[model samples]
Target: MRTYFLLCLSIVLAANALSDNLVQAADPAFTHGVASGDPDRESVLLWTRLVSPDSPELELTWELAKDPTMQTILKTGTATARQEHDYCVKVIAADLEPGTTYYYRFRQGNIVSPTGRTRTLPRTAEHIRIGVANCAKYTGGYYHAYDALADTDDLDVIIHLGDYIYENGATRPGDSYYPSFLATGRQHNPPHTCVTLQDYRTRYAQYHQDPELLKLHARYPMIAIWDDHEIAKIPMQKSPSGEPIYDAAWQQRFNDSLQAWHEWIPCRAKQGEVIYRDFQLGSLVNLLMVDTRVCCKSKVDKTEASLKDPNRHIVGDEQLAWLKNSMLTHQATWNIMGNQLLFASKGSDWSRWPGFPTDRNQVIDFLTEHPRINFLITTGNAHNPHHYVVREKESSNILLHEVLPGSISSGNNTEKSRSNPAKLKKLIRAQESNPDLLWYNNDAHGFIVLDLTTQRALVEWYFVTDIRQKQYQVYRAHKLVIDVR
Candidate 1:
């Protein structure tokens, strides 16, 4: 641990020096670049941050065009980057055409932000491809996955499953939990777990300045939801062994993190405090995003009764009703369930749906009852990729199909089990015991591409060769096709 921290110290010192130089720059600059997200048929949200003279607020004008060039500007507006909001600007350019692409840029006087491209949801569609990715730890590896994702031209939108930025303490060299942690010369911004609003904002800025992440964000609009790391390991998380830490200032930290999330992430949340919402992708898909990480999850207790308790809700009651209603009500070709946690029961992993069997069965029962819903689920959090034929039990009928894409940068199952024979055996045992688990990759660092058409949906697992270095090659490692009948 001593040597691990020494390496961390060096990376932190180097990063801080670079950060100091950027902070001292004079003229106004769009240091983090531009991004767009929360796309709907008529409008989309555009985002950028400006570094300038330390003023209370700065007004910036934005223009949206249908073309890459600014020759024919479609929409123009102005927004303010206030000091309280960490000098970030977000604007919703509304009343645009459906299924249309728009290019936008922000200008604070002479300094113009990079132009970003975004597209609105279509009213009708025969084919669409959506990219799914999660678990990008800045210290764990290079952002090569993001760079590869930015190059995919066929993708329409991206869904981030969580762990966008880890709130954990600074990573140490040879960190076992992550592959190649701190080998890429990147360290957590504050070099500590985030406990304040500024900490969270600074962490986000660290990620935003990454060229690959900036490139991807500037290209496709993202639909993101938080998982454990968003509020995990920080001011309000449990102890390492899952024991509650009352001194964490839980509520305040939670509030601060969520505030920063709303400010930095380009999401069009439907309610003030709710992140559980659905997006209609023309007639092809209805993307129902739910909050399993934070909406209302009872603390984990290992007792049999506690684990099986109907009252110990992980997804809560109201969200269940909303999920069931949305699943039943949608008329699209596919009702895609988006979760930060896998609804599948991975035997010993109680943090996911398996922890609350009652609620897991409840969701399973609803899907079994409504067979016509044509349900499919995309889950994240696990670094490895997983494919499941979701069911209540081995004998139970199929409830829905679930898929977990490989992490964008986090360590894979192979990395964790490499030196530990028992760990590898445990995963093998779990796989042998669970028949519903069709397949999962023990090793991979990549993303998932979901291709949808009226008759079928195809999940392509694209993986990168290495994350230890900046340059790497990406390839489609696996593919699964689901027939929608």
Candidate 2:
């Protein structure tokens, strides 16, 4: 018994020593961890945040390696993390091989941060897989969907369609907006709505603390765009009465939010560039991401006159022209648009593309003119998964496909859809009334997996069994295919 006890004591002592060494080696300066994004053939963007105790400026050393072990360094550089940019460091690592996986890390003195893995865009490939997600509210539930995607090794990139963090406060027992019965232990940090830069930063820190989300960012490069919740519940530059709503205060708040967003997200943007940009994944796909919440002109109104207005602009005139030019010039096999709202024309809810019918129809006309091109629109903010085949009005020919992934942990549509069978039947009948409506499911909460190839693009929808439970199973609920050949 004495011999066994001594052995156990020695083992415990060794374990404690190892743990202390690890703690001593780690750098608490990088509280948010490392991330990489916006990969082209020859370059990619790397990001990290340094927490300075006394110095306003900290020198951070970054290294890129071709292997996960980082034995062979491809590139190394030094960047200054300054207080002007919230102590955030963004470096562009160039001269990288196309379609090659690389690992990166940051160091300051003897402390080192966690390594992040990212890959460059392929110059040419036979197959590419992407993970799509959106509407992740910290207070809604756990981020199991992100965890699942992080564990999967087949995905080439991740496209996030916004609402990354909700600006609202804690949910009480009697809140009518969200399902109070489904509230989890997670809650916002500020305990109030976010309006200033500090408030937004606090909210972001709270959301980034989730291990699943951090793991996902550490594993894959992400392409993101913001929606309503990031700025306001219903963000519009103009009011319903046709007056400018973005006054000085509102503009400042918007600026604050944008600053925080740009600082945290690993995007390929210069100091003054807009977020909308295009990525060419070799000859297989052309990916375009757009911002819809910032420059939109009018508030949502369901009246006939409001819908028929020719001056209404959802993406502004400049972005619209740019989109058209990109569509006309791209020669890839497939064109995928990362949008924030649904494109199908629906009932009086005019906050989506359906509200701006003129611009929407213009895009549809462009798609109709080019029958050989396979256009796929991936959107979020619906909190429900939908598959729609939009078609030309007169000819009834399919123009494009819109795939919407369900929310990460937001309230399910089942409550509203199952309240009354008669009402549900009426809703279904109304949806089927449109010739373009193909599939709709609001009962589940999950993300989507998009598998692209030279022949066809397959969309697989996976749903978490329950959002209330910590440990849940994800099962494939639906699959849709678009022939690209």
Report the number of clashing residue pairs per model: 0, 0
Candidate 2: tens digits of C-alpha lDDT, residues 212-291: 78777778888888888877685655764456676789877777877888888888775347788888888888888887
Candidate RMSDs in Å, in order, are 7.7, 7.1
| Runs off by more than 4 Å, candidate 2 | 1-28, 176-183, 239-244, 270-272, 299-302, 415-429, 432-434
Which residue pairs in model 2 clash with each other? none
Residue 295's lDDT within candidate 2 is: 54
Residue-by-residue lDDT tens digits, candidate 1, 1-485? 11211111122123223333454568666777677887889988898887767677888899998766667988999888887878888889999988877778878777667777788988887888899889998877887888788777667789998889888777775566444754566777898899899899989988887877877787789999988787765322343334555645777787788888888888876325778888888888899888876656767778887875667667778889988887667678898877987777766766778777777778877766667778889999888888988764546766678999889877777777777878988887888789888888887888989999999999899899988886799998889988886
What TM-score do all the candidates reach, one by one? 0.90, 0.89
Global lDDT of each candidate: 0.78, 0.77
> Where is model 1 more than 4 Å wrong at Cα?
1-24, 177-182, 234-248, 270-272, 392-397
Q: What local lDDT score does residue 245 receive in model 2, on the 0 to 100 scale?
A: 71
* Clashing residue pairs found in predicted model 1: none
